[model samples]
Target chain A: MKTIAALCLWEERIAPRYDRSQKVLVVHLDHGKAVEASTIAVEHLDREELCKTLIAMKINTLICGGVVDPCRRTLEQAGVKIIDNVIGSPQAVLSRHLAGALSSGTVVD
Target chain B: MKRLQTPIPPELILDHLAVGVFTVDPDFLITSFNAQAEELTGFTRKEALGRRCYEIFRADMCFEGHCALRRAMDSKSSIVRERANILDKRNQERPVEISAAVLRDKTGAIIGGVETIQDDSNRAALEKQVKASYSFGDVIGKSPAMQTLFEALPVLSATDSTMLILGETGTGKGLTARAAHNASPRREGPFVKVNCAALPAPLLESELFGYRKGAFTDARSDKPGMFELAHGGTIFLDEIGEMDIGLQAKLLQVLEDKEFYPLGGVRPVKADARVIASTNRDLASMVREKRFRDDLYYRLQVAQLELPPLRERREDIPLLAARFLQEQGALEGHTARGLSSAALKLLMEYGFPGNVRELRNILEYAAALKPGGRIEPADMPRYLLRIDCPPAGAQRAAAAETAPQSDSTPDPTPERSETERKAVTDALHQAKGSRSETARLLGISRTTLWRKMKQLGLGW
Candidate 1:
């Protein structure tokens, strides 16, 4: 089955605060090849709603910068894998994640 | 007689004052420390000098983004009498009132900052005495109803039984749920909360129990729901009465079997989450009306807690009002001291239909409308003015009717403002018309004393 990942994007790099991120980038992969991508505008929703949005999108993985305990726990409990505290451009993180080089709590500035 | 002509040092002058005074450079490094500052902070001048002010005084706001000296320097203005707490050398918390101003060198260039600190233990104790014991996490209430709730929280938080909370809108249903999660053994786990009424049935269903990649166009990959995410923790369902009838059956299945199937998944996911549900509507009535399922309602009611509305707990009004005022003042950089007696009376008399949330909004409005100093009755929102509180004229008429027969004698019960004005005038007279001296005696800021004198039409 193909995997989908969502990255909390600020401008070019990941957002500093996961709960207050306004933009989310969802990427779809088939056999490790990029198939489709979408940008979701999530400024209207709060932290809880943001989690629900990721779940609804069937996003199995989430990549972002700093995430607080409550938000990280909620995402983890939902069975979605999170690689947080990553500090890099969305493209770099996505590439790293695809290569399986990205690990949770690694700061890839 | 030959008089000894010796000039008193500047440090000696500052040391003789009752209040603690200190100076800090633009970088927040301690520059000069008076004797009183040394005594209050338990740090000598030798130890305090050349060190960061926070390293010595260790005020709560020093590293909390509310440093008075930093604010003064940034704004190039004076912060008149803001209350803060500091930790001394022994790590004892000492409440203090801080006033700071930007210091300028020759040629009008900003140099450093000067701050004065006064011990506020007596004042803080009195204010705490007024509020009594009304604190639990973020929940604030002093009424018997809230007390009962507080007493039951510890025991309820220890168990994972399905618990139902009944309360009106804005009555702190969510706060209580969070408090339970924070106090529970599973506090390390996630607390997932969903407002059942916030989303439509389709979206809510997907949100609660996720779907497979091909279940829908948006579902590009398998996803998990709030229940799965709340494993070993808690899931708060707010406005549970608004949940869809069909969804309620599915929820009951999860509660019974401790497992639930995703929308398109063939396998059932284990549900390790504890359920905490809340509703504003009467579930019994909803069950009778066929809007709510009887079985689901019974399952949720295994442990029930009914939160009392703010109107029912009137005794907590003053405390809540004061707390809100202080919070607003701190956030907005205003000096909101307190409320006028008339304003407090108005707040007490008005029945808050929207409960504590409404009270918070009301105070926010009053804080903006108030020109300066304490909030007055006139500062309240116009909507609150429409509420049928007893008018001042009615009180005067009632007083007149109840008074014993007298030949045009003066009324004995004076208004609070009048008494305050008389006290200010007397203090000013005793201080020989020095506003600063009067403020020190009255335990207020010189700015406040000046404002009072001007408002009261005192010639001085």
Candidate 2:
């Protein structure tokens, strides 16, 4: 199925904390193949507003590290599936996700 | 004093301290993350070192430019005992008392800054418990609006005028009415509450005025109505707008003549009971639509008290939530101390359609769900997520309440943001760019005022 996923970002690695991430990498996938990608700077938005923005973008999944409950609960309630505590470069994480091997609390070598 | 030849390792001592201590370089990258800091931020020293400080301390102040460490570095001084919040690894918000100071090299060159964060969750919860004593009877509020209501309460309670309490459902109209009765001169007399909407027209009349013996098949003996029972006290007519027109006319008669006759008796009994009517409905609109009697509306309006909805008085949310957590948590035998900062923020952002009652219900549910610590966001009712964020006006108001001042130039956009921007710009000009004074004039926090100004492009 076609889907959109957002990975919370810090430089080249996945941010260790979802609420603190200043940027996000959004990727569009078609049948497990990446089709498009873009980066969003979110330093100006608060946690709640950031959640709203993700929902507004119709993101189907979220990949990140530790997520505070408020944002996690809110995003999940909005139907955005969260893959939390996943650590790695955004590209490596996306590759694992596409391979159906990524799981919660995955740590990259 | 003589200095010891061998000195204790400062890093070891810092690691042993109860408070979390971390240091960041001039570029704001972490240089040292002590043991307590590791536990609090949920990051190992290996992972935390070399990362940006803001990434570890995802505090509201950090995003809003109220960072204590930043302020300390800029001022070349120490910031002692300031309260702030940071999100832990699991995204739970932890309240902390922070102190920050610039770190200098042995050569006296400014190097970086060190911050110490002491968890204050326990102390904060304890402080809230102490505030529970400030509540006026069962009703609790410290907002100016509530204070005004409190100031007017004694005078209203002293008089016998028919009082109309107006508010949205669950905004404590019932409680306010009860407080009025308890505070009145007729405290010894019974305080009767009648739900006008709960009964049919025929039964409602009999329930209000009561019936004499043999009046109906079920009427075995003469019975006193609520008004009669509350002879020298008060009768709280809840949802008064729902009363039938015929019953309303009879009520109007009682208000006018101070007497009501039994269902089948010729003799009229004096009804000295003070009447306090309450409704969530707009009685004025009801009168205009011929759904409610104008005369009855005016009678109840003689002494009106409109309770502000919980959203309008956001300042009271923390106190009310804390109070409910204590009262309900104790009843449930739960160990929940208080709500986390994120949970409290959620409560504040939600527009409580059900008002204070909804807040209490939320807390009761949270108290039951939370294990043995501060109530975190996950502990709150899941349905709270379904509630939409409050209107933009409210959001703007809230933003203004948290913002700090800035010296940046304005960057106006052609977007439809004139009203709010102009207000902030004018206020800032009047206050001579003093953020605190401008915030005071706008009835918001300097942080909030700064945020609004930033959002509206009033301040860069």
Candidate 3:
């Protein structure tokens, strides 16, 4: 059983793009967790609210297209594991995360 | 040759010079007049000969009835360079400079005076031209804020990097963005603008990334979005805070990839557009609330520029007002006379809540009321004239009473405010009460959030 978050591109279902402020979806999984997932919108939330909401939701990982420097530092300080630059459907990206096959490169584009 | 040397007549000597000349006896009667003087007055020398100089010129004598002739008589010396205005037979006023000398007999006894009057009409016309040329462009001030902005503009213009402009609504953010775009390498490229707050999410999405033919029910034909149209150009997103969460994420992707898929389109299109976003709202706060995407915020904020509000740069009001006046005057075809010293003082003392925009509006309104007239304090708006000068004691008492309540009342915070409070709490909770991390998630400087928490007495 593993829970992973995937921040996907809205227009392209094939590949997901990272959010500018590094926001992603928390995908709950345990072989069969009904594919239930929730997105974290960090566009308006400051660092404090963003961290608090994620922790309250008990998200294990954050997958976003892009992460701002301040939020990246704050998330790293909170001991959150970041798997960035993952684009696609939540289900497809979650499979890669579970199989330990996600790229760790920072997506700035 | 030595036989007949007739003494040159004084009248003949005076009549030939181009300058007007006239003389009055001690009796104040016109005694001598030259041809130029006759031409200037529209009267022949024969008609003006016996009339009083004041009667011929239609001019009141000096304050003490002391004309140039009277001065020569009193001092028994020549009175040179005396200036006055004279009225001709037709009552046309003329400015004249006069020179007079006392006529003395062999015994050195004082007599009537000989006065020379020269027209100064050309000099007056030249003075008028000089005054007209001194206008708004002459407004000068050396404030640190202005100096800093001027120095920063060149550097900001050199790059095509995304700029995040932060300032109050009327603080000339749009102007600054235009200046930066105009100065940049993209000067020749199209400069597109989108007001994030003015349009709804669906329209904004379509506007930014054009939809394909039959993309939606109303889709008629292929249209280029701002991203495509502004390719090789700059796009300004104003009030970026109002954009929806989904759009924010999409925008973030576009920034990251420099590519986007039009709505309902199969292919991804590459966009080579520079982004410049501006907002009065606190994006960092929105980020913390999970309303704004954190990643997008960072991408858009590569180079941040913050403008001071009008209140912060009050010294620029006079310069801004003068510029506005000249612009309005030129458009309206009137002389742009500047404000009186008192009016300038009043403007400096008032706080401009609407910033530079409001100042322009005020000047335009004033100009409409009194075109080409000197702007006195009375000409200012009624509200500005009645500004409350609060007593120091009252202000201190008010601050003391109001300051504690905001921190004391932690109960029943309204929905939006409470949501903001909750958002802060959530960020703090996830960060394990780490203020610095919380500030980052909140998208605000640590100092600002620190002050907010301290004011609310929300002990972490």
Candidate 4:
């Protein structure tokens, strides 16, 4: 059962693009319930390094803003499912994701 | 009533301009967004302000930190006519031309960054412009890696920080060094190249920091070192990893103090030369092993650019080959014009261990073997035919696609896949999911193991 998800970030707000994000908020989900979350500095990492870090963290679903095709494909190839083009604050974004209402292109004010 | 013409605010003048304009604070949050910016990015000024500019326009460069505004701010220079693609509010691709610079306050302190965008949706103009800047100095590359490096060179050249260039053998380290020097503000200064591996410690020391008269038996007259000769210019240290640890300390002093002591002189002479070092060696490992100085390594790499080898960016092979062949043709009385497509395909399939230098040598050999015009596969060195490539149709399809390619396209034969699967699975089981051990047991490189795992859907 897949559970771990990562939300790419810019400060407290979800960055509009995955590649440009400086941080990622990693969350652990149990039976669709949010449980634990933490942030990892991701600004210094290149696309491949960023993918490797997430994969090492066992993240299966990545919730973020627009992802350039190359970055999305790289993550997908590594078995991390990407839900891109999302925008909102962490609380709002995580809430929608917990409700199973989060998807690509979701703009939560 | 006399008509009073209230002077139009300059802010309104900016809004009416055709070019898209925007400003970002130090944190990269949008401080202002103009009307033209709204039309180009599909994000209104209200929606953009206070939000990060990256979210509004998901540009390819932004994701990789190759941002134009970021570059301008870092290198304290302006970026003009750089090309980038972004996704609009509607998620539609918007091709844009960027010109950017750091924004300064009243006291000339950098407060933020400002950028102007020009619509570059005209494919014809984009292609034509791309061709003109395909090569920087003598280094030519159209691949993404080269393009990124090309953008970085100007940014790096503008600063005075010590630069360390990393690359494999024959990967144009020298050309890149020369290119950096040419583009740098110190272009008029003498560019000196010193190979650290070339001399013994004593000779190299004296050569670098010249000896005074009567300092040694051989020193009959006062002589200036490479450091002195390179004053007001750039000094390139090639193969810096091979620099002796003892000499490295002195070099570090020069880097830190901006001066070096002559072999026999009492006073420290000011060394005004800028330093750019290059090496094909792994300095990090050398530092770990204590063969290289850790402090020097840190200081030298304050700003570094790495040149990718030929095998990793195979898309550049054809372009590089054409340039080399054309130059070789001119050199050999027009004996070689170009390579046939079949010849190019064979060259692409081969992993060029020697990088660009090897390609040049091979072309020179072929040019000598063939009298004139397009060189065919038969005219090439026999050693280049070691690898068997996919069918021509598959290669064509790959060339036609502009998107990122899969791990390995034109799928491996079923027999090969079955063998790889069994070997990898067995190795993984034995290694207990340790990729390094699996690769070792299977006698394949680590990167190869990772690619096979992805291709076979055998993620651990």
- Fraction of true contacts kept, per model? 0.00, 0.43, 0.00, 0.43
- Candidate achieving higher TM-score, 1 or 2: 1
Instruction: State how far residue B274 of model 2 sits from its true place (Å).
Output: 0.8
TM-scores for the candidates: 0.50, 0.47, 0.46, 0.47
lDDT of 4 by residue, A27-72 (tens): 8988988788888899877667788888889898998877667777
| DockQ of model 1 vs. true complex | 0.02
lDDT of 4 by residue, B74-186 (tens): 99889998889888766567788999999999999999999999898897466757885788889989899999998898889888789999986678888988888888899
Q: List, residue by residue over B1-460, the lDDT tens digit for candidate 3.
A: 5775788898798888987788777786778889998877656787678665644554334422566777788888888887676655443557777788887778877657777778888887787665433321232223567566666666877887889988765567788788788878998999899888667899999999999999998899987899999988899998887788899989988988889999989999898988999987667867887767899888988888877766666777877788889999978878877999998887787555445665676676578778999888877654456544232333223222221122333443344344345556765775578898665544343554675576556874
Per residue, candidate 3 scores C-alpha lDDT tens digits across A1-109 of 7664535333322122222233445577666453676655555554466666766766666764334455556667766676653334455665666676766532121
Per-residue C-alpha lDDT of model 1 across residues B144-228, encoded as one tens digit per residue: 9998888788789899899899976667888989988888888999999998977899889989998988987778999889998
Off by over 4 Å in 2: A1-109, B1-134, B334-336, B391-460
lDDT of each: 0.78, 0.79, 0.67, 0.79
Better-scoring candidate (DockQ), 2 or 3: 2
lDDT of 2 by residue, B368-458 (tens): 6774578888876544654344644543343322322223424333332554455556656656888876655444445456566766656
Report the error of model 1 at residue B14, Å: 29
B207, model 4: CA deviation in Å? Answer: 1.2
Q: Candidate 2: deviation at residue A78, Å?
A: 61
Q: DockQ numbers for every candidate?
A: 0.02, 0.22, 0.00, 0.22
Return the clash pairs for model 4, or none: A65-A85
TM-scores of chain A across candidates: 0.90, 0.95, 0.59, 0.92
